[model samples]
Target chain A: MTTSREIRLRSRPQGLPAAANFELATVELAAPGPGEVQVRNTWMTVDPYMRGRMNDVKSYVPPFQLGRPLEGGAIGEVIASNDPSLKPGDLVQSNFGWREAFNAPASSVQKLNTHGLPTEAFLGVAGMPGLTAYAGLLRVAALKPGDVVFVSGAAGAVGSLVCQIAKLKGHKVIASAGGAEKARFLKDEIGVDAVIDYKATGDSAAALTAALAEAAPEGIDVYFDNVGGGHLEAALNAARPYARFAICGMISMYNAEAPVPGPANMALIIGKNLRLEGFIVSNHWDMMGDFLKELGAWHAKGQLKWRQTVREGIASAPDAFIGLFTGANMGKMLVKLA
Target chain B: MTTSREIRLRSRPQGLPAAANFELATVELAAPGPGEVQVRNTWMTVDPYMRGRMNDVKSYVPPFQLGRPLEGGAIGEVIASNDPSLKPGDLVQSNFGWREAFNAPASSVQKLNTHGLPTEAFLGVAGMPGLTAYAGLLRVAALKPGDVVFVSGAAGAVGSLVCQIAKLKGHKVIASAGGAEKARFLKDEIGVDAVIDYKATGDSAAALTAALAEAAPEGIDVYFDNVGGGHLEAALNAARPYARFAICGMISMYNAEAPVPGPANMALIIGKNLRLEGFIVSNHWDMMGDFLKELGAWHAKGQLKWRQTVREGIASAPDAFIGLFTGANMGKMLVKLA
Candidate 1:
C-alpha cells in the first residue's frame, strides 16, 4: 500500500473560491485491481472552467458532485498496471482528480501520445485546447484565408491556441492580452498581425476599433471570444457585416452569480447577417485526429507556438486556477507535481 | 404624355407614423429610353422592413431614398421596353417603387419565371419570401432530417415557408402565431406538428416550452425566429443543448424607439453551445435558381402552399405594411395596384 495526498471538495463555492473550500487529506492506495492502472500525478491543468465545476448549477457539462474530488485534464506517470494496455514507466493523461496518486480503470486513462513532443503538451496545445480552437474557428466560424480573426484572453490557454491556429490557417490574426509583454509576444514572436494590450488601452471600444482598422482594414471575418460580458458587446459593435463569432468560453462572466448586463445591440446582427455560435471542446472530440495532425504540422513548420504557466504542488492548483481570471497565465496553466 | 400616380415620402417621421408622412403625387411619365423598360405595377409587397427606412438609420439594405418614391418588391406587366433582352407584354418582378408606372434599366426586372403560377405569386411564394424561408432554414440553420424545428411568427410569409420546408425536410415543426385561428391553421392547414397561440397563452415561455415538448419529444433542434425580443429569450430557454437559431426578422421590437427589455438569457447560448445566425435573402441570390426549381417542384407536388394578404389598392400599402407588426396577415402581405 502507498500513501497518497488527495484534494477533496469541502464545500460548493459561491464565486471566486477560497482555500477553505478545498480539503487536503491523506488516503491509502490499494494495489491495482484487475484492468486498473495506478498513476503518480505529474502535471495537471488549471482552467477558468474549474469555477463552473465548483458551482451546483447545471451547465453544458454536469455540475461536479459535492464532496467529491474535482477532476480535470491531467498528465501522470503510471507507477504500475494490471491492465495490459498500460504498464509501468508509461506517461499518461487522464481525467484524474487533484491527487498525488490514484488507481483508475484502464479505460479511464489514455497513454499520453506525445509523439516526440513534450509529454506535458498533452494538457495544452495537442489536447483539448488544440481541438477547441481548431473546430470552433474553422468549422463553426468558417475561418478562411485572408479572413481577419480576433481573439480575447489572448494569454490564456484556449485563446493562445486560437490565435496561433488562426495564423496557421492563413488568416490575419489579432490578439488582445493584458500587458505589453504578452502583446509583444503575440505580435513579434507568435506572428499575429496585430496585438492590443488591454491594460494600456484606456477605452476598450476605441482600442478594439483602431486595432481592427490597423490589422483587418477590410473587416473582421471571424471573432474567437473567450472573454465575454462587456468585451463581447464591444466586439458586436465593431464586428463587420457578415462577421462570424465563435463563443468558445466566457471566462469574464463565468463566476457572476447575478445576470451579467451590457449594451444590447443584437439588431446589428440582423443588419450584418452575422453568425454567432457558442461551442465547447467536449462537443468536438471527433476532430482530435485532424486537430493533432494539423497542430503538429504547424508547430513543426514554425507556424504555431504555445506557452505554459507552471506551478509546483497540488496546493498551488487553486491559486493557478484563480489567477487565470486575473490574466496571470501566459498560456496553459499547469500544476507540476515533482 | 402619360400620367402616373405614385406614393412619395413627404417627410421623415419619428415614433408612430401619421398620414402626413406620405404624399400621393401624379407625374408625367417619359417614354422608355434606350436600354430602359417601363413597368405598370400590378402587385406590390409591404414588409415590416419598410418602416425601418422611414427613419434615417443605417441598415443592411440601404435606407429608402428620402423624398423619393418608396421602393419594395413588386410584380408588374411590362408596358414598354427599349432594351434588347426584354419585349412588351412580358410579366416581371422588380424591386421597383410603389408607383403606377416607372422606367428603369432592363436589368432592374427579371422576367417572372413563375412557370405559369399567378403573377402576384411573384411577391409571395415565388419570390423573396420563399427564398428567405428556403435559404434561412436550410443553409443557415443547417437543419437535418428528423430535427425539431420551431418558428416564431409562423403565420407570416417567411415563417410559413419555414414550417412547410421543415415538414418537407422530415422535421417535426412547432409554430407560434399570435391568435388561436392562425395557430390552428398552422397545425391543421400547414400540417405543422404543433402550434402555440402567443396571445392566448399569455405566458409565451410556458406555451412555447409546452408546444415544443408536444411536437419534439427529442427536444428542439432549430428555431427560425422572426418576432425576436421576449420570444428570442423564450426560444433560448427552450433550446436544446446544441440548437441552431436563425434570425430572419425582429417584428416584435422593430417599431420600438428604445430597445425592448427582459428575456436576458444570452448566457444560455454559451451554456448550451447554441448557434444564432442572421441573414437576408437578397445576399443569397446565387442560390435563387436552384431554390425556385425546388420550390416549384414542391408546389407541383402539393407539398408547398402559401396565402397572400393582398391589399386592394396602392393607397392601402401603408396599412398593409403597418399590419405586419400587428399580425394582421395570414401569409405574405401584398398590395394590388391598377
Candidate 2:
C-alpha cells in the first residue's frame, strides 16, 4: 500500500477563495486491480474555470461536490499495471489531480509520448491552455491579416500564448497585465508591441481605455478577453467598426458575490458593428489535431516560450489555486508532486 | 418656381428630443437645370435610426448638421426631368426627405419599379426596414432549425418583421412589445408563440426575465435585439449555450444623455457561449436581392401583416418622428407629405 496526500473541498467559497476552504487528507492506494494501473502524479494544473465547478449551480460542467478530492489535469508515471496496454515506467496523462497518486482503470488515462518535450509541457503550453489560445484567436475571433489584437490577462497561460500567436501571424498586439513585472515580461520576453500595466495605472475602465487609445491609435480589430470588468469595457471603447471579441474567460468577475454591472458603453456594440463571442476550450477539442500540428512546429522552432508558478506538493494545491485570483502566477499555475 | 416647406435641425438634443429642437423653413424650388429633376414628395419615413444622425458625433452616417434639412428615405413623383433615364410623372425614391419638393440631379435618386406594391410600401416593407429584418435574422443571428427565437420591440417596424420571418421559417418565437394592444397584435395578429408586454410589466429586467423563462422553458437560441437595456439583460439570462444575438437597434437608449449600464449578467455570455453581433443594413445591400425575393413572396401570399401610424403633411413630420419614443406607433411610422 502507498500513502497519498490529497486536498478535499472543506466548503464552497462565497467570494475570493481562502486556504481554509480546502482540507488536506491522506488516502491509502492499493495495488492495481484487473485492467487497472497504479500511477504517481508528477504535475497538476489549477485553472480559473475550475472556480465555476466549485459552485453548486449547473453549468457546462457539473459542480464539484463537498468533501471530495477536486479533479483536474494531471501528468503522472504508471508505476504498476495489470493490463497489457500499459507497462511499468510509462508517462501518462489523466484528470485525477489534487492527489499525490492513484490506481485507476487503464482506460481512464492516456499514454503520453512527450516527443522530446518536457513531461510538464503537456499540462501547460502544449496542452489545454495552448489549444485555448489557438482556437480563441484563430477561430472564435476569426482573425484576419492586418488585424490588431488586444489581450487582457496577457501574462497568464492562455493569454500569453494568444499574444505570441497574434505576433507570429504578423499582427500588432497590445497586451494588458496586472503589474510592472508582468508588464516587463510581456514587452521584453513576449515581444508584444504595447503593454498596459493595469496595476500601475489602476484597473479602472478609463485608465485602460486611455492606454489602449495610445497603444493602438487606429483601433483594435480583435479583442481576446481573459479578464472581464474594466478590460471588457476598455475593449469596447477601443474597438473599430466590425471588430471581433473572443470571450475566453472572465477571471476578474469569478469571485464576485453578486453579478457585476457590465460595460457602460454596451450600446457601442451596435454603432461600431462589433461581434462578441464566448467559447470554452472543451467544446473545441476537434481542433486539437490542427492545433498540435501548428503548435508542435512552433515549439520545435523555439518560437513558443512559457513560464510556470509551481507549488511544491499536493498539500499546496489550494494555495496555488487561490493565487490565480491575486495575480500570484505569471504564467501557468501548477503543483509539483512526486 | 415653387415654395416648399421642410424641417431642419434647429439644435442638438440633450436627452429625449422636444419639438423645439426642429425648425420649419420654406425654400424656393427652381425648374430642372441640365441633368436635374424636379420631384414632388409624397411619403416620407421617420425611423429610429434617424435619431443617431441628430447627434454631433460622427457615426456610420454623418451627423445631421444644424440649420440643414434632415435627410431620410422619401418617395416622390418626378414632375419634370432633364435626364433620359427618368420622365415626367415617374415615381422615384431619394434621400431628400423632410421636404415637400426638391430639385436634385437624376443620378441622386433611384427610379422606382413598384411592381404592384404601393409606392409608400417602398419606404417600409420593401425598403431598408424589411431588408434589416431579413439580414439580421438569417445572417447576423444565423438562425438554425429548431432554434427558439426571442425578439424585443416586437411591435416596431424592423422587429415585427423579424418575429414573422422566424415563424415562417418554422421556429418558435417569443416576442416582447409595449401595452395590451401591441401584445394582442403580436400574439393574435402576428401569430407568435408567446408575448411579453414590457410596458404593462413596468419595463424592468426582472419582469422580462421571469416572463421569458415562463415562455421559453427550453431557453432561447437566438435573440433579435431592437430594444436594448432591460431587454438585453433578459435575453442574456434566458439564453442557452451557443445562443446568437442580432443587435439591430437600441431605440430605448438613442436619446439618453449618457451611456446606460449594460446587462448585469454579461459574464453569462462566457458560460453560455453566447454571441452578440451588431449590424447596419446599409452595409448589407448585397443581400438585397435575396431579401426582396423572399419578402415579395410573403407579401403576395398575405403571410405578412403590418400597420402604419401616419401624420399628415410635412408640418407633422417632427411629431411623427418624436412619437416613436412614446410607443405611439405599432408598426411602420410614416408622414404623408403630398
Q: Which whole-number lDDT from 0 to 100 does residue B331 have in model 2?
A: 93
Evaluate fnat for each of the predicted models and list the values in order: 0.54, 0.89
What TM-score does prediction 2 earn?
0.98
Q: Which DockQ values do the candidates obtain, in the order shown?
A: 0.46, 0.84
Model 2 ranges off by over 4 Å: none
- Inter-residue clash pairs, candidate 1: none
- RMSD in Å for all candidates: 3.0, 1.1
State, as a TM-score between 0 and 1, how close model 1 is to the true structure. Answer: 0.91
Query: Candidate 2 lDDT, tens digit per residue, B194-251?
Result: 9998877767789989999999999999999998998999999999999999999888
For residues B163-230, write the lDDT of model 1, one tens digit per residue: 99888878888888889878878888899987878887764555666665665666788999888765
Among all windows of ten consecutive residues in candidate 2 chain A, which has the lowest summed lDDT?
Answer: A258-267
